[model samples]
Target chain A: MAGYKRIRVPRNTWNMWLWGWFLVAPTMLGLLILNIIPIFQTLYLSLFKSGAFGRGNQYVGIGNYERLIADAQVWHAVANTLLYTVLVVPLSVALAMIIAVLLNGKVKGTSIFRTIYFIPMIAAPAAVTMVWRWLYNPQFGLINYVLTQLGLDPVRWTTDPQVGLISISLIGIWSIFGYNMVLLLASLQEIPRDFYEASDIDGASKMQQFFIVTVPLVTPTLFFVFVTTIIQSMQVFDVIYMMIDVTNPAYERTVSLVYLFYNNSFRYMDKGYGSAIVVLLLVLIMIITYFQLKAEKKWVNYM
Target chain B: MGIASKAAKAAAYLFLITGAALMIIPLLWMLLTSFKTVAESTSMNPFVFFPSVWRVDNYTRVLNQNHFSAYYVNTFLMMFFRILCSLLFSAMAAYAFARLQFPGRNFLFGIVLFQMMVPTQIFIIPQYLMVDALGMRNSIFALVFPGFVSAFGTFLLRQFFLGLPRELEEASKLDGCNIGQTFLLVMLPLTRSGLVALGIFTALFAYKDMMWPLIINTSAQSATLASALAKIQSAISVNYPELMAASVLAFWPMLLVYIVFQKQFVEGIASSGGKL
Candidate 1:
């Protein structure tokens, strides 16, 4: 039996080739047809402008790219997305880190608190945005209701171009705060106790230990949060789409790049422009990802 | 645990309580609004703290009207099938990539990784055209078709498989098992937790999906819960209580799942960042 098994082993390698093909065929075919093919198709389609309805598409080459650069609305969207990322990345991580640190202790209701915090992450973006829209409603929303109770003027949370983007950011922070908190808290628990114990023996205060020992150990997870928050913030669409009503005049200020992509492609039927916009987004994401991967060596402490 | 001082514990409690309250305020307000009268939910000036009389009308109204029943069924059907297919196809491909050697493996793997990085909206326009060409638009199949398998799941599960010791497969090989047998009998079952984690991730992604569902399915008849809610939100307009009620109703399935599988739900998310 052992001799036969040894002889059969030589054939198993060849069999593995067939088995591997069999195993991966479904996903491979799906990826090629749904992902890889369409990816190139989008790129190809970008070079040509679509005609009326389903008529023939015209070759545009770099014409769409030129228009994208000149389009004021597109630039405005890029600026809005970048600015929102700047505002959200820091606050989401910092606020969540504070909450995570507070909850990492051996206290009662930690799980309960953690559960409550993660609810927004669990809910759909539509659900979260809808609720927030009600809260930010000008005349009778909960937020304005609270402001008026404080004897202050009710500010337009989702209106007034000045603060519309800010309103979106606040909602973004609130939604992501719980998610970042839980992830950071889980990573905090993974940290070894020896570092803290050693710091304690050296007479480091609790606050000092947090900065010196805890912070260094958690930097890897922190970097993960940073990359995640940055990428996600740049891609912010569902919330903006759901929250800012078309009638709400503040819509102009809060339009994100993805939102613009949707408009040019679906609403305006400017498929070429939409393709260029997304291709630009794709390149931006790739560059950002490349830099993040390179920069991880500088400060992301694995040990 | 013993290292914590009483004073520090008290401070932690205070901080956590306040933050937790802040975390839940929107959901709490949503729940309250869902139960309030329209006049109470949109009450201005004085602002009603609690409804003078709690009403169940919004729940009944939303469930009975606004095509709520169809939306609920469609969403559940899409979620169930997507989760089932994603797990199966992802695990098969992940096992092959992780364990088997084949020609062009590196190139194929690179494509999977690239798919993982691109923003999903980038896929929408052409995917919509593809679905339209297939004459499947405004159908649940189209809503679930492009996502029939997940590149992320394949990548993540491959990582899980690579972490396993080689001896498990070798030992199975000693029993005259084939590569397929080794994967099924000796390997795949061992990756249950990894599979569960990926399953939860898949479910969450499908549930929260907005743009794809909204764009692909034009009519309410084919709408998933998220798209249905988006439609209802636009159609219902500014009736705060009903909107809140619809929002809360839209959230019930997820809330129920979270409550039941709290640990998996939290860990699936806490699996950390880049889920999109």
Candidate 2:
């Protein structure tokens, strides 16, 4: 009986193993070919001077990186990308936090407000950019018209290099704050009402309770929103691509890493250099995320 | 409650109402501008709030002059196939990872997480080359290639499957059901909400995806709505009314569906921690 049981256990284990491998085979293969292999392939491609139509290639180890280091346009894109992230992250997070707290309170028509705010998140970014472009039109835009109505100078919304990145950041903040609000609302709901009641009984005002009880508990989600928004803003592409063009004066001021990569890879057919540029973005994101994770223990409260 | 709290509540309402208006004005403007004439749309001095004629012909003109219908069809097809593939493959892999104890399981899941961490552009150039090698560019297959496997879906569904109880599978095994039968007949039916969330996310991502469609299918005949709207923007220099009309057409389907399935959309996004 013991011998028979041992044989049955091994056979069953074998069958389960076969089924497990069979089930996972398709996704594993797809990721290997479509995503994983391509990462290494891109890294390999970055080492060469790619020919037309992906024909003959001359390998130039570190040459693309060398050029990228001295390339002013690449540095400009790096700065612009970082600046866009800086401009978008704090303001959007603060707005989202305030709105989340407001909606989390005893408020009427919370769902209505949520639906309206999230509409921008659902709309296509390309379409959103087109609408904003029309709004930013210098000659007859509603924004400029309103500015003139208020007896203020009509700022060049998209053309002026000085004001261009800020204009794009406004759209960025508008589109994303709702998403951050939703995440914050979710986390806020997780906090126990006992904490609020306790604070209230301690003679804390509404504003005091918010800072003492609400903000500390919501720090985890706040950290998440901050990190994800920074990573996403670093990859700003469609809005900048749609709003500013090569001929626009703000192109240098608004060009992001992904946009520059798109131009290099597709427009100029410099796949190798594009690969190198994207690699730089990947490394930068990893470094930033690593630091965020390390700093989490200092500020993020899991309880 | 008290006087101070009443005043605070009223203040909160005021703040929320103003914020909601600011969020909605751009979309409302898009709808209003779609019906205006060129002169009215571009009118500077007076600022047209509403169209003089409320022309419906802009929609018809955009449809007649461009490949708007083709874009609709392509976008729908892409969304359908992407959702289908993601659900099927992701469910299987997620079940394996969540339930079955297999050798190298941790190592394999690490690969999925690594893929999720990296930016998607790292895969694009080589994906383009692979599609070109297969002569599949400018086709629906090219549009749906990268979505055939989803790291995000796998991770999401694994969490759901892990939440499920193990008793169901144990009972199915005692009833003479094999692993496949237990999964399909017993376990799969229990995770309806998970599947729905994944489906919603896949569809939303597929709809808003511009870069892949733009790069893979360059021609208007095969373009998605997002990319086609981009083409219209670039093709016509200053046709504000027509451009607004195209924007309206491109986004209204999503907005309408969102209105109808508002709860699902909100819960799907909220629960999954999904971003647009």
Clashing pairs in 1: none
Candidate 1 residue A269 C-alpha distance from true site, Å: 1.7
RMSD of each candidate? 3.2, 2.2
* Candidate 2 wrongly placed segments (more than 4 Å): A1-9, B1-3, B274-276
Candidate 1 chain A TM is 0.92
> What is the Cα-based lDDT of residue A86 in candidate 2?
96
Q: Cα deviation in Å at residue A129, candidate 2?
A: 0.3
Q: What local lDDT score does residue A290 receive in model 1, on the 0 to 100 scale?
A: 91
> Model 1: per-residue lDDT, tens digit, B1-276?
465687778887888888777778888899898898877776675668798878899889887777777788888878888888988998899999998997777888888988888887777777888888888988879878877988988987887788789999989999989888899888999887778888887888888988888888888688888988888888888888888898888898899999999998787666634322
lDDT value for model 2: 0.89
TM-score of chain A of each: 0.92, 0.94
Once superposed on the true structure, which residue ranges of model 1 sit more than 4 Å away at CA? A1-10, A52-54, B1-8, B271-276
